[model samples]
Target: MPNLDDKNAIAFEFARICSLAAVKIMEIYKTDFESRGKDDKSPVTDADELAEEIILAELEKCLPGVPVLAEESFAAGFRPKTDGAFILVDPVDGTKEFINKNGEFTVNIALIENREPTAGCVFAPARERIFVGGDDAWAGTLKAGETVSPDALDPITTRARPSGGMTAVMSRSHADEKTLAFADAQGVVEKVSAGSSLKFCLVAEGSADVYPRFGPTKEWDTGAGHAVLNAAGGCVRMPDGAPFLYAKEEVEYLNGGFVAWGRID
Candidate 1:
């Protein structure tokens, strides 16, 4: 395995891997492909499988023997043992958005150490935007089929909650009554609807102040975004104000209600 102490290298490598997956995802996005339902009734597509295959293969070459808990792999009944450190990957987050052709889906990859996310990358191929966070947080443009260097990334930080009022970004596909209620409770001046982990990126980049998810989610779905938000001076916490943890063996990787805050008061 690569040096786990070198977080910078891990972050950069994850960005590169996610970018490669994005290239292929964009290709599939342009084609007329149909999505099939998984056992849980969630949508899956060729892009999801292909991107995961590419990422898993690259990870094997980059960090051989390190365990990975990837979305597609778990659904396929492959669960690797995880201890102090491991990786969580969501090859395609927001498949509904992808199927809708709304340009909101993302490729997510994250490193978790001691149950906390240490580094991660979220790439929205259709938006041509890639966000990476680890020792540092950055957002950059990514042209389809092109490789980008870490030095080329622009640093990003979360802004303080606006003095006027906070802005909230809600999940477009998964927003439920409870989530809406939470947004309303925040007294946000504006509410934006987005898909995938982009809601976390929006807060990380200061475009929004908070993202409260009250619905069902998995660790893989939130780990990468949590890392980015943390690196950008933000945090994800349970509704009761506890820190969000990963790899909960008892829960089967599922996450409970949590609130992502750009500015923690």
Candidate 2:
């Protein structure tokens, strides 16, 4: 088992890499950056490549020989060999938001140990905010100069308790019928729309209560936000209510259906 100190180091390094990537992403965001759509029709930008390269370089330096599975490098044919640990990276989680200049995008990084996310970080440069999660609680949304403020150390919330009516959040880009059906099954009173992992953050902060994702997504897309929710007294569970897991080879790094709730019961 990894010690608490080692876990903290992982969280810290993950945040550092995310912060560095945030700077690069913002640089490209401020200018006219070219955008293209991948085969899956998701938007990709220069910011993604620049940030991923920087993150990969830094992670290589800090965690030498550790395997990395990143969205940008996913095609490189590197696979986790079972037995040890690897890092998952999604340099820009909300590329569409970034491309549209909406500033909802983020840099996500997570360390997976024994196929579980032991530590993770999410940085939103446009908001000058960062969230980190690990064994010793977590932190969220530090202003530009403030460093390392610990998130409230409270018990994680398991499920959404109906308060008159529950809140539901869905992807602005990928909200599909199945996600809507799940939300309807919950009898939600209101629904909000957002892009990327910000949906997870919204649920974590209690701004929204639940987020149901039915469309396809990669492990890196949800890993850091899942860790943040876990730290912020919340959780991301499968439709059947099991906690989310990462780095499983069975699914080509793609995630199954999951629900993120402010409180899990």
Largest lDDT belongs to which candidate? 1
Model 1 sits at a Cα RMSD from the real structure of: 1.1
**Count of clashing pairs, candidate 2:** 10
Give TM per candidate: 0.97, 0.87
| lDDT of all predictions | 0.91, 0.77
Q: Write the per-residue lDDT of candidate 1 for residues 1-265, one digit (tens) a residue.
A: 4587877678778988998888889889999999999999999999999999999999999988889999999999998887768999999999999999999999999999989999999999999998999888999998755676778889999998888999999999888898888887878889999999999999999999999998999999999999999999999999999989998978789999999999887
- Model 2: what TM-score? 0.87
Q: In candidate 1, what residue range of length 10 has the lowest lDDT sum?
A: 1-10
lDDT of 1 at 256: 95
